[model samples]
Target: MTPRDGARISGHQYGAGGELCLEYRPDNWEPQFTGAMMIGSAYRLLSGESPSDGEVADVASAHRQTVAQEVRNTKLRLILNTTLLDILVEQPLLQAQPFTLDEHWFAKHWLAHPRRLGSPDAPPIWAAAPPLTEPRTREGFAIRLPDETNVPFEGSYAFLNTILTALNFAPALERMTASDAEMPLLLVHRGTARLYSLAQGTGSRAVYVYRTIVAPANEQRLSAEHGVLADQCVAIVGCGSVGSKIAATLTRAGVGTLVLVDGDLLLPGNLVRNELDWRAVGLNKPDALAARLDDINPSTKTIVRRLLLGGQESSASTDSALQQIGQCDLIIDATADAQIFNLCGSVACAERKPLIWAEVFAGGIGGMIARSRPDLDPPPYAARRQILRWCDDNGIPWTGGDGEQYSLQIDAEKPPLIADDADVSVIAAHAGRMAIDLLKGGATTFPNSAYAIGMAREWIFAAPFDTYPIDLVPEGQWGPDADENARDELGGLLREFFPKAEEAADEG
Candidate 1:
């Protein structure tokens, strides 16, 4: 085989505007298959013609298959069932003239549910119309069908009405004056109808509205696998990088309601590792995260508490917050603050709810995720104590401790933490998975109740992605032990304050 002039071929990942990526065996490629030949075949195929003769039969077949797949992948923008247009289609016949569909028709006759956008460049915004008695007017024209021919590929208004004119149904077509050029024109062909938006100058283009139903967020297909998540309520403390990401993960997984607890502003510096963007800057973290979670899944409700837990709040207020957190199905302490963890631990143990927490190490080294269930693991403080001992036994000097296993926030005098977004995300995701497992209840995905995950070679981590799972055994029961001697002495002393039973009965 001989290479063509000006044909540049390199192993670079990217290519120029006209760069052609051709893969072939240098020693066994067909002599006739040259760069020019391939480009010519591509051009011919794009022009809706056979690429080449039998010299590239297999290539042509593969190209056709790819084109067919692309066509199949094309999805419609608007969605409405054929049944919705029956009344509008029949109204023109009763009036014996072309008619306009006002907003009332859209509101009463059409049903709509908001469609979730899967990507940024997804289809146009959906217009979901569920029947309401609201009187809203839309500039739209409707006409009776001409015949039962399949939907034509040509979208020109003139070309389509020309068929109506030939069928002697031109009266309605003539009624659509230039003033109504902007309105959508509906052409009914018996059971099916085609909608077209007539632009002022350009030819009309078909608005492909599918005749299918849209399910609400809770009823979406994801509900089948995540129905448990939809019914579970979770409270997340500390709406920072880890907390916000975990909240988003749970919301996307269809958690019914999130109790967001935080008292920090989303500063610009937080964007590098936090899930929130610049739009949330200066806003309270809990409120901002609530809005973000709604955007992710509208069905996931959020209750925002913009108070710094264990941080200068009134005892009454803190107790109220803890009471609310305890009511949730699960509590997540992403704060990694020892004091906050202790508060949350008290609530979890008293409420008999599951508690989960995680922390990303400084310098993006690694992180740890742990959970404590009332029935299985010890209290939150005891669990942290065990993890700290585990780290010490493994010779991993724990630098992040406020008399606890780890601390998410460091002192202002020390160097600033340096964990990147990816590092925080790794820990947050693991924490989220653990939360979901706790909510699902029964068999667990993670047998161990805690783990120390390494993202780089630091501390006890020998290599990147090193993981150590630590099993937690149940500790002693809660509350203080009773002393028989102290009880007997206190009983004799307290007997002085109260009357004897015989004297009390006589007085009564």
Candidate 2:
């Protein structure tokens, strides 16, 4: 059935849009979904036919969860912090308790601008059921029903009057509504919660309750089912377009700690491919990325090191930053910079850490992801050299040298194809997946340590999604080969730095 303009109807499972929210689609559209059938479903629903199981479950779920809500007319916000949620869950039904109405409570709980607080024309009334403070708190009442099956109130006055009558309290509905004091009535059915302000000046005005807490076991269950790396530590060295994205991906996957090392500022042009936006524009890349990571998962701790590796930075700070990167379980190089890669290679080899790096090819055509594990493959530098050799052998002109964002700046003959954010994200996400695989340990997803993934038709890629797995031969030992005499000299320096535990104990 077609809906008419500005027409409102009260019917089962029908929203303001006049479309039936719940219905069935037949396997064959032509024969099963005729006009008669469509009208039959609507008629049954409007005539008080029982809603399908899916519809009943949807209502029950919505009623149990407290999400962000707002008053349509007054534009007042309803806030429910974790503290209030805990009390509400512990005691489903509570008599009218003291609640405070103030603007300061809203300011402290949310991240809104002062000028944009509440409504624009006038100061909006804010209320907290269990007032965050005690000095200005007032008495409030609330109820927690088993479900929303038999409640019968249509407006604010009716709701308050009904609630007071059921609780056998002296009906003060008039006194509560006529005054400026905040008497918020919290209605909870099963787990869903709604808040109605008695002093809102509008009938049936319930401010939406924005529940500000996540269930603890919800994240754990999600991570456990997906083999999440919740206890692993990872270090990402390039908080650019690729680096920032990798950081966010890992954080969202429940990685416990991330060491973010980047020595650059988020520029205006970086928004094209960078995960960060204008809010982070002048901030240091690592600092901004740390904040972004926090927004994704607050439990994921971040150690930000704002120092450019292999640059003209102070030697002490550079070495300190490298030391932190070496301590991580896995290291990812998203900088696409040779100098930074070289420094990371040195740290990865010396610390016996796993390394994963990616480079998006010129234009958004494709990218490469390479990894070097301690005993599984050659060192980071050797693995990279082999990737270069594979490119040479395949007659694919290497297009990864120019230090640009996402892609290299090719000559006039082969004009560089500017890669969009999606192109960079593709490679970055693969790098993040490889990082997770390394952190998880044991069986790996990528049989080959290096892969050239094609996003578009270019270079060796004949069509999109053409993946070439380059086999990297692990040649020589894990660390650099040293002469016997030089090794003896290095042993003496190492002994000076770290004495035997027994020797130190004896000396003490």
Candidate 3:
């Protein structure tokens, strides 16, 4: 009977009102739906057309951004949520197969990787390894997502007994009756990204626990596995409200290296938009944000420098500061300081590196998320000037809004443009997502762009997603290239300024 009386799971069958269950095709390999495989599946779904590196990244990014609900009474996310599993099954290889790991082999691998975390549920009985040298394979089934399983998960011991007998391991099954370990029964379902395991009741009836499999923390092969941020070197300027939030986001996304620059101590006001709490009020901005970042992701190497960019005139500290900016794979100017942004933008353009600069308008009326690709996008300084002009022509206030109480610009002497932390956080989250997307493009030829998202509650800024175009200045003078020799061991300049970077470098 094909699931007529009870749910059918692989070779097992259960009566009605049993625990949630799942099954696999006879020949599918577990753990094959990796990042590269997911990318392949997403590409195929995009119409059999071969995709560029950027295109594969674009599709897989959505999966990374998906939300998962909490696991049974835990902070960890459920790995095999119906929505996520649907996407995972997109890859052809994820189609169910007739395959099962040897019992000993499964036990060995499980024991090798100690349960660092998660539910400790296990099975009451054990099965011996199958001696079959060749596992069977089948085809002709149409591709589809796995059927939804019942909630309050469980498995059956009779199923394991059948498996043991069929594989000529009946003696082992008898020994399991005498064994004391109550480990949960684990199954490697065919064509699924997850392992299926359950704790069984030791009685005549089939009862089990709700324990389920989980995603390994070390799965960082691609954006699908680690949200496309596994190997990024990101340097962020200004670890204040906006900068601090963006830094936290980048770290959580698995950025490999992070440089946080902000010289000032965390003021009491910073707690509003800042991810940090009041305990960190006295700490330097970079230090506070760095510690917070470490807590978010210890693997993310964090280097905090206590020097405000553009806050100081030309000096050795400034030179070192510039070098710090020069050394990263990508530079994010979260600093609202106009002078520093222009300086950093020029250097990034000259070096052909990516630069993402974002800022919130006063009173959180709106904010801009702008990014430039070397040789492809406009210089950040040039782009910012054009954006400012656009805002001016559009009647965006530099200081106060209707009645002069709201602000749109952040001049050093003016009142705060975005006074509310919620407003700052709204823009910061948007900018953070954009930054991740830029990195996923992987050095592709995407255009330079500025994105503005307005908060409608303020009524002054009502636009949803407004795109502002910046004039392409092909001949702008960018600063020194961090790649080419710039400093000596003694911190003295070794090379003179080279303004002809455009002519010297390849446009591609």
Best by TM-score: 2
TM-score of model 3 vs. true structure: 0.49
| Tens-place lDDT digits, model 2, residues 1-508 | 4357635443433346555543653232566577777877656555444355434322221122133321222334444454444555555353543333333344245211111112224553232222222223334555565564455433346656666666665534554445555565566655555555565453444433322222332324444534557778899888888889999988887788999988778879788998898989999989999888876777788999888675556657877998899999999988777757777877787788889999888778899899999878988767888888888899767554343543222245544337889999899988888887777766988899999999877789988889999999966456543122334434453354346643787799
Steric overlap count per candidate? 6, 11, 18
Residue-wise C-alpha lDDT for candidate 3, range 131-193, written one tens digit per residue? 222322111111222255222233455654554454454433443354332333323334443
Lowest summed lDDT window (length 10), candidate 2: 110-119
Task: Tell me the alpha-carbon RMSD of every candidate.
Answer: 12.0, 11.2, 18.6
Give a tens-digit lDDT track for model 1, residues 273-379: 88889889999999889878876777787999988775555657777888999999999999877667766776787677889998888777889999988767877
Candidate 1 has a TM-score of 0.63
Candidate ranking (lDDT, best to worst): 2, 1, 3
Best by lDDT: 2
- TM, every model: 0.63, 0.65, 0.49
lDDT of 1 at 279: 82
User: Candidates' lDDT values, in order?
Assistant: 0.65, 0.66, 0.54
Model 3 spans with C-alpha error above 4 angstroms = 1-222, 225-228, 312-314, 395-414, 442-448, 457-460, 463-508
